[model samples]
Target: MFKQMVIILMTSVLVNNYVLNKFLGICPFLGVSKKLKQAAGMSVAVIFVQVMATAATWPIYTFLLVPNNLKYLETIVFILVIAALVQFVEMALKKFIPSLYKSLGVYLPLITTNCAVLGVCLNNISDGYGFAESLVSALGCGLGFMLAMVLFAGVRGRMESSDVPKAFRGLPITLIAASIVSLSFYGFRGIIDNLFK
Candidate 1:
């Protein structure tokens, strides 16, 4: 059990990273990564929604869907849970953390469809992780996403002031940078294997 927990955490945070390994949320990676401030805001929002959605969806899968042999409903249920969770988080942030809401702004809605969130939930289910493990995995995945996005944002900010060829000016350069980061993350595969073993 302890080993499983560690595996979930390590895999989500590094080995199977949503951004670098899974390539789940590249849209936001490229779009909201222009500014470190915005990147931080989006990351926080993702963490909140992802954790909440995982907490909510895990039980629904384990207690409701799995029991009834309705596993086919997993995808739909997960999507609904994530969407509602994102909406609730958005409203709560607007009421209490007005500044955060302002910073997150439109990106809050984007969280609903963010493939990273859905990917985490699906991965958790496929791995046969229990409620607690799933939650931890989701949180780790969210943190990993934030880490990657913030790192990319900082790099891009510097790149904005750097000289580069005209052909590799925008998306091409960004993809190249992402590929480098992805290669770096591959090192974590050893950590994941050791943890699981």
Candidate 2:
């Protein structure tokens, strides 16, 4: 069980990363990564949402959708679940962590539409993961997102201090950086297979 859990974690975080490999949550990936503090705050929000969404939506699919043959509504159900979860998080942040909430501002609210949250929930059902496995996958997805965000924050920070052509100074260079990061992650293909071999 422990070994399988490790595999799931590695696969999610490193092998099939939501941001770098799957390209699921590029909005916040690029937006919040401008500063390390902002990136960390956003990552924590996403991780919280990922775990909560997986917990909230999985049993609904298994007990409600699967048994009732309502699988066709899986996407809609997951989206609603995630949106509600984000709203809850938003409210909690506003109440207890107003500083972070204010810092996050519009980007935080935008998490409602972050496909990564819904993607993990949908994948949990589609992959037939049990509750524990779904949680592990969510952890991986969140950590992977955090990893990419923090790493790119460092990259962007360095970029800001360096000299670059005027035309490639902003979003253009950022996109190129993202592409390079994605290409690096791509090289890990079949890594899970080889690890167990």
Which model scores highest in lDDT? 2
Candidate 2 has what TM-score?
A: 0.90
Per-residue CA lDDT of candidate 1, range 51-94, in tens?
A: 88888888898899988999999988899888888888878888
| Global lDDT scores for all candidate models | 0.87, 0.88
lDDT of 2 by residue, 1-197 (tens): 98899899999999899999888999889888999998988898788888998999998988999899898998888888887878887788889989977865555577888989888988887898899999999999999999999999988998898888999988999999888888888788889899975
Candidates in order: C-alpha RMSD to true structure? 1.9, 2.1
The list of candidate 1 runs beyond 4 A from truth reads: 1-4, 193-197
For model 1, where is the 10-residue window of minimal lDDT? 188-197
Q: Write down the RMSD of candidate 2 (Cα, Å).
A: 2.1
